[model samples]
Target chain A: MIDSQKPASAQDAEHHRTKMQKRKAVQDKEVASKTVEKGLLIVNTGAGKGKSTAAFGLALRMLGYGRRVVVIQFIKGAWHTGERKALERFEDLVEWHALGEGFTWETQDKARDIAACQGAWRVAQQALANPDVGLVILDELNIALRYDYLPMEQVLADIAARPESQHVAVTGRNAKEAMLEAADLVTEMTLVKHHFKAGVKAQEGIEF
Target chain B: MIDSQKPASAQDAEHHRTKMQKRKAVQDKEVASKTVEKGLLIVNTGAGKGKSTAAFGLALRMLGYGRRVVVIQFIKGAWHTGERKALERFEDLVEWHALGEGFTWETQDKARDIAACQGAWRVAQQALANPDVGLVILDELNIALRYDYLPMEQVLADIAARPESQHVAVTGRNAKEAMLEAADLVTEMTLVKHHFKAGVKAQEGIEF
Candidate 1:
């Protein structure tokens, strides 16, 4: 009765179960094989939104684990953002810094721009050196490197010299090839479509 | 003397300032032209990480404004995650639900998977229908839709029927073309490089 009276759905279900059991075993083996652990340099770059936002998400996660999280914005000015307000609630574990005046065009002063980048980099270097800080986010550091405001070679060296167990997340568009090579993980946020193109203004609590 | 005695760097700086001033004028005008404001149908999809992480980031932003943010995970099981722990801190403004047992392969049971999707959809429907839910995140709903666990037409209809000012963020890979067409913003997280490829295990407070 169990075999002869089985419905089509039951047969299909049994087939699926068998296939899945085999797949799960292979996946479990593969997962178990991965045993290395070290600090990771994560890069979030591309033309789409959420590079910094995703970094902030990682900050939240790191903070959740009762670790120190430092965010240093390189190109974005000290704008009022919802993430800032929310993250500041975890004041004990969060160190927030908005070091730039805005984008390069917004700042316009080449000397001042370079000076700001240098200042931000100093702060970033300190965070990177700190073994106690679980995650250090150099927000929009790529733009500074792209504009030659900071030496890419020195930045990469500083990242390499960071604490072995401290993760760093760098977010921006046009991440330097050298930076990408140095990164353990890189995610390019591709812009499939944008609401700003559709004349949707950046709203509070959403765009920020 | 003002022009002839000027240093090369100063002259270059002046040129850059003039160029930037003109550019800023155009940008300001364009920004001012965007007057329309409404809820955004945002989609985060692709073959990379952070699709769900970015959604949680948005949830955090929404919660900053004392607004309600509901996250309904459709494909992910009730796994212990750092984002869940941190977001739960804002108990009054957040509603978290992890309805699926795991991925399709992990579950294997077609009937059970479909039932889980339906249950998740019901929860999502309630949040989407409510105007007070500033942002409703349909996490991994694309995977459920990709597998035909839920009717795409009905899902889209419910999203469209939501209140005018209720924002919705749908996250997963391989989002439907129809959904893309209906979305105000769509970001595809492209995997350039992944740490997992290097046999780096998913560490707590990082991958989770």
Candidate 2:
């Protein structure tokens, strides 16, 4: 009935339409089946860039909904990152705390690093307890956990005790297995290629 | 000299400091070697979420530096996404064009899909040609390329011919081999676990 009288292109279009129609029905059913709603514990990890970037993106999204966002940087100083500057524009909705001086190699003091992590964890606990906050971004928390700067059990306990409707995003490379197990969503940004190998320096607004 | 007559913790600390000093020297030299500067063709792909989200985050970073950003959404409609609404706050610095009405299954007309892709590609070419635009995001461009709605050769050619200092981020799943080859940086987001299978619906300000 369809392909007999139609031109080649028309026949192809009709065939495609039929196939798509079947797919749409299946997709619609699957989508309708998902009914549960809960705050998500999101983990972004791996060797590639954008784990923190994507977390900031989620922070921006929460701000779009007129929700409060708390950002606690665990392992790096808030040394003028473009995202930090941009998010700071939403003054009333954002609470940012950069707790560390720099990386472990730069600091080279285990005692100091542990103290800083403990300080950041205290701040994180307060944020988690606040039901008014919509999203809490614990940037580079995995690195602190990996180094055993803070007790992982206490961190997980605090996260579990957070408000039911509050979302949290934890980011860093080499996320712990227990952390991954606790997460509702986990994304690993795998590095396929890097421009640094080709002699490109980190540029402002591109990498920070 | 270092470990003699000292507490165990103090000796361990001294050893750590010495090791870190060596690592810092190596890091500083490697960083000093990279002096070249140029725009990058970045690709974000794979099955995990945040491909487009990361691109938008980069757009926000560019905006923080008071630079221009152009976003061309290849397949998704100009739906009420939180990121779009948030980015639209920077009216003067952002140019956003959401070309397609929806996905292939939703559209189902190859001709219409091709037309939409061509329209978006035209906009992309213009953005690529402009030196003022710091970053141009081709969101879901991989899907369009995978469907063969636009010629991969032409797409790559346009990107290559863009302004030297203009960065471009192409995002979507199943990126073409040629696209990956042409990119200066490539990040493949690998999905470890998603909440959707656990009956969790995509929440507003989280998924969108």
Candidate 3:
């Protein structure tokens, strides 16, 4: 009954199975013990590129379940993004506000950036208060926090006071330590390598 | 013309407008110079949890633009993922094949696992051959490669031979050096914190 050409041994497989069964038991028990249910404060930050993209994907997942979602853009409001165009088709399910003037470096004015961030925060607070919105994505909010465009204490307090059942996602680079500490889930995107450094130009559909 | 309560300075606003105009010109030039259009090999790897989620998000982005996409799950076929159920609404736009039996440790049979991976690779190769498929997501492929379930050289060769304009996303932990070398863009996810370690269980509609 031995298959000589296979990549793994039968004995190895059986041993793995036993080990996994035990692991599964532990995993199942661990998973079961997590009974706490509440809205999550998710932070996607670091030098990697998918923080905002991942947040947008979560938004899309929410929309798939027919839940209403609101996205308040803090920095990437200048260009038309693929996510924005795609979500527009789900007009009935998504409320998108591309509120920022543009990237901070492009604007080069701290005062204006802070003002734009504050403007977005007002709208986000309203989204947080609305029970109809199941998910609120504070896109690139971390950039504003990094630049002190909005007071960290106020942002933290506002997020903490969000509706019990409403989930919130914050994305950007160099997220504040306070924000990270308060997050239920924190994913740091590390840049192993980027195509931009290799002289590869950004494609419209892919980059934006 | 300066309002004390305004978020933006009138002068600053004008300066930003001029700056954006110049920046747009430069951006347009950079974009124009990037005329080479071809399929991209994107890799998401590391200890972070959003690798597959990010890849799925990329798939959703393609679906948003009305392009057909394919997702072939390698190590998570046993459980019913929220994404699999959610993608069902886009019946015509998506082709999701959860081909794995389960995690390798659970099955414990290396021969069987290798055969399963080989079978799935054949299916994936067909998906790659299809010109209409805009994106192909090889979910958890690194796991199969890690365990030597499938031949890595064959996998890389197949990916390289894919249609010129199609996009391929491979997600998992500990991706091989060859895979990373071949990838056009790579994002390494670093796990800063996970609820599982905090005794948090997986929740329905959230983790699944």
Q: Show model 3 residue runs off by greater than 4 Å.
A: A1-8, A108-110, B1-35
TM-score of chain B of each: 0.95, 0.96, 0.87
- The sequence of per-residue lDDT tens digits that candidate 2 reaches over residues B1-208 is 6657899999988988988888889988988988988889999999998888788888878888988999899998744378877876788988989897787889989899999999999999999999999999999999999989999999999999999999999999999999999999999999999999899887888887
Superposed by TM-score, candidate 3 places the C-alpha of residue A71 at a distance from the truth, in angstroms, of: 0.9
**Best model per lDDT:** 2
lDDT of 1 by residue, A110-195 (tens): 89999999999999999998999999999999999998999999999999999988999999999999999999999999999998
Predicted candidate 2 versus true structure: per-residue lDDT over A36-94, tens digit per residue: 88889999999998898888888878888888999999998854388877876788989
* Residue lDDT tens for model 3, B1-208: 5456666667666666677678777877766766566678999999877888788777767776788889998887865366676677678988988888887756666677788888899989999998999999999999999988888999999999988889899998999999999998899999898766766666544566
Show the lowest summed lDDT stretch of 10 residues, model 2 chain A.
A78-87
State the weakest 10-residue window (summed lDDT) of model 3 chain A: A1-10
Q: Relative to the unseen true structure, what is the C-alpha lDDT of residue B129 in candidate 3, on a scale of 0 to 100? A: 91
Assess each model's interface with DockQ, reporting 2 decimals per model: 0.70, 0.75, 0.41
> How do the residues A37-153 of candidate 3 rate in per-residue lDDT, one tens digit apiece?
777888899988789888877776777677788999999786536677777767898898988988765676667777888899999999988988888999999988887789999
- All candidates: CA RMSD (Å): 2.2, 1.4, 4.5
Give the interface RMSD values of the models in order: 1.4, 1.3, 3.2
